[model samples]
Target: MSYSPTIYKFADGGGAPVAPEMALVRAVLEPHDVGDPQLTVGEDGSLRFWIRASDDSEAEISADETGILVERPQTGGVFAIVAELVTKLGAVIIDPASGRAVCRAEEQTRLPADMREEAIVIDMTGDALEAALLGPRIAVGPSPRAAR
Candidate 1:
């Protein structure tokens, strides 16, 4: 069976499509002990994951061609996880507020100067997830009774 996130739409009636990039993002996030991860697609084709940022606050990480967008009521603890994801995906975090690359300075060079000023760009292609989909499959040999 394949993994697909439950789809949802914004109040504005816009929603994103299910894309392979989301699977890659989920693959990168699966091993973490972070709160139960919930994936959602936005109207603009952005994939987002929701998690608890704190006892009282919620956070969301949205990924698109531009990169990932980290949104939280408070960025304190959530930023660490965002940073880790940036590193794992060979991407960079861009602070939308300041319009600057805030983490993974080395990866900043990968994005065009214009995009660097916008979204947090995770430098991953859908190809990054090709391996995850190729899990080992069991061969269906003849049933025991049939063999007998």
Candidate 2:
């Protein structure tokens, strides 16, 4: 019941964003099975979506500049969003605390092992990105749920 937005930056290049942005939401359901849908933004700036049962864990999914590519992973359970054009240069982590979600940039520019408890939230853009790119500080904002 929480939404965290995190912005990732490309290390080598510093221009137009060529990386895909992903947002995952989870909800409780019956034993029959039900899971939250995944949200993805392609490099070309297109929206892609998918729905899967909570029981089906492995679902192969790719969200790149072209769009969304749906496939079932051989491993089974847990869908993997492929980064074709965007290399996922870096990632941010956002956590819900009190009434706000704290957004923090990765210390090493990679997705950490613990993503559930520590996720990333993207709350700033344009000038905000400029400032963050300079100092690399955490962004705090009202929870997307609370904003409404």
Candidate 3:
């Protein structure tokens, strides 16, 4: 008998496609521990585009120490958004601000230069998460047992 892996991509209601701002907020804040001086995600989409953080395990985070807990925004995209947020907020300060500090992929610069430090700055501990959510991630295959 022969078996072959298959790939499938699909979208869902998924509790309403989180708004761009909210998605960015989620991507930005979902990477820190509780009460870790970081913002959090709220239920009511009142102001989705605020900021937040998390503190997952080493294996569960990106190199930049972001999230791998509750999946939402695309890993790389999330990381880009967060990195950009960090850069904007002066978190990962890169005096040069070149190379990985900023990528030349996204159309409009991911993070702006006016991101308020008060808006960002959470305690998302770990590097995997940072890598997974705030580093350079590339889209790959879909899950074999996804709820699509």
Best by TM-score: 1
**Per-residue lDDT over 47-105 for candidate 3, one digit per residue giving the tens place of the 0 to 100 score:** 22222333222111222122112223332333434445433332332212121222222
Predicted candidate 2, C-alpha RMSD: 15.1
Clashes of 2: 14
Error of 2 at 116 (Å): 19
Q: What's model 1's lDDT at 96? A: 34
What is the Cα-based lDDT of residue 131 in candidate 3?
47
List TM-scores for all candidates, in order. 0.45, 0.24, 0.21
lDDT of 1: 0.43
Off by over 4 Å in 3: 1-46, 50-71, 92-148
lDDT of 1 by residue, 1-148 (tens): 3222111111111222122256567665444334443436567766666654344334555567644555542323444444445456654443333444433335545555554455333333222211122222356788999978
| Worst ten in a row by lDDT for model 3 | 2-11
lDDT of 1 at 118: 50
* Residues 1-148, model 2: lDDT tens digits: 3222233333333323334443322111112122333334345544443434344543334445422333432221221221111123233322223222223343223343333244334443322322322234367789999988
Candidate 2 ranges beyond 4 A from true positions: 5-7, 12-45, 51-54, 57-148
| lDDT scores of the candidates, listed in order | 0.43, 0.32, 0.30
